[model samples]
Target: MNQLSPNRPRASDQMWLDAALDLLVEAGVDAVKVMPLAKQLGLTRTGFYHHFRDREALLDAMIARWEDKNTGNLIDRCDAYAETICEAMFNLQDCWVDWDLFDAPLDNAIRHWARTDADLKQRLDQADNRRKTAIVAMFQRFGYEADDAEIRAMTILYTQAGYIAMEIAEAPADRIARVPAYVRLFTGQDPSRNEVERFRARHGF
Candidate 1:
């Protein structure tokens, strides 16, 4: 069991949500009950009341956190300054390469949970559409027509999601070797040597 700060009166709302997310990732949504989390936090069940009204409230907060951190932050990074479509794609790649920023385990867990929950399935669908829209806008900024941009964006985003779902195990060397080709295939533009080097340096691959 994980313990909270010894000096604090109790855990914060975010702390509880973080613990819940950890359990969700490890044992699915069914394991994200208040009693287990309270036990993990070294607190009583009543302590959870200080933060969430009930399990549903906690679940709702978790989804909101996921949206803010994963969707909102990724979209913001995509909208950051990029002189070309390739650069914009690279900007998005920064999120993909850095698992810490994107939380792939949490993403996989939520997606699995959505398989049986209609409401959650709807939420996931909306998030996917929004993400694709952001990617399309990035291509449009590089002068691609709306239809072309949409198709390219879908291909890029879907391919990334497929990579995650497949859980392909490969040597880091092999994966790095494929980066240039992947960038070309996704963006329809060959990445410059400097761009590839910078990506390698950023990801240390």
Candidate 2:
């Protein structure tokens, strides 16, 4: 298991990991080389080595940190945002849009490096499975029965990301506009009419 200090007050490793993710979002994942991250954090190569065995170790750590944050807080954050169309996602689409639009492509670019780095790819797969499982549970919360919820949620997890790719490549708003359809499909509700609207109108469709 990947150990984390999530219940603790945070550590320099955590800061380094956050800085790395910031670099990922800002300059793409290729820029997350150990040397560059160490320099960005004012650490010498020796200092960086003390924390992570190498770039692969650092990448694994980064993925672990992201999963920790996601599993711990993502659902709560969506519920707190409970008054929007995404709230119907229970708003998961809202939570991940930024990452999918930006970081996921960056992650894909990093995968080219993964072909030569077995450990990084292994960690990546672990992180990917953890995220998929969490999202599936979130769908069950939206009222799908367990087995069906897992299937529907995985469809969104694996498939809707193409919309993010298309939006990034071409017509952004049109791509985003279609996202609610995915949530509706999973929830067995129609985007054109939801419980929120039904409540507002005091009627069911």
Candidate 3:
């Protein structure tokens, strides 16, 4: 299990990682080489060596950053306090709208990268399973039965995965307008006006 860190990495380390991530997202992992990143950042290869031992080490760090920011924030949202299942769903949905909570582009990039790397593909599968487990637990905490919770968790997760895979785009207002209906469909219960308002407020909708 990878331990999640609350502390940010040093500024110089993050700078290299950021450049590598952009290259990864824009041109796939093949383009995220040390030479490319060094050129992109206008930094010498020596600077990269100061933070990472080699290209492979930098790649490992990239995966760690993705897992920490994306998966870590998701689990945190799943465990966020909520008085009802509707509210809880909203809390988790925060990941959909909040880039800080979920870096969907990075998630997409990593998923694509994993397609060619067996070890990374395994880690990606594990991450998905972990995310579903958290969602299932969240549902169970609100009185869902074991079987119902499992299916509900899968539905929510797979739906979002579909959105990401398809690169679906929608205006913020349009998506927010659909949230109440979506929450109802996912939870079998409509969110209260207060719960909906709170969800909107959090997203500045």
Residue pairs with backbone overlap in model 2: 86-91
Residue runs of model 2 more than 4 Å from their true location after superposition: 1-57, 65-90, 100-102, 109-114, 163-172, 192-205
Better of 2 and 3 by TM-score: 3
- Candidate 1 vs candidate 2: which has greater lDDT? 1
**Model 3 lDDT per residue over 28-141, tens place:** 998888877776766666668989999999899999999998999899999999999999999999999888889888999999999899999999999999899999999999
Q: What is the lDDT of residue 102 in candidate 2?
A: 30
How many residue pairs clash in each candidate at the backbone level? 0, 1, 0
Error of 3 at 11 (Å): 7.1
Candidates sorted by TM-score, descending order?
A: 3, 1, 2
Best by lDDT: 3
Q: Rank the candidates by lDDT, best first.
A: 3, 1, 2
Could you give candidate 2's per-residue lDDT for residues 1-205 as a string of tens digits? Answer: 9464555332377767878878865676678887787667666666676677888788777666555554334444434434433354635654454443235544554445456678767865775676667666665655667898678767866665554345456444554555556656666765555643433232111
Residue pairs clashing in model 3 are: none
lDDT values of the candidates?
0.84, 0.59, 0.89
Query: TM-scores across all candidates?
Result: 0.89, 0.56, 0.93
The segments of candidate 1 whose C-alpha lies over 4 angstroms from its true place after superposition are: 1-10, 170-177
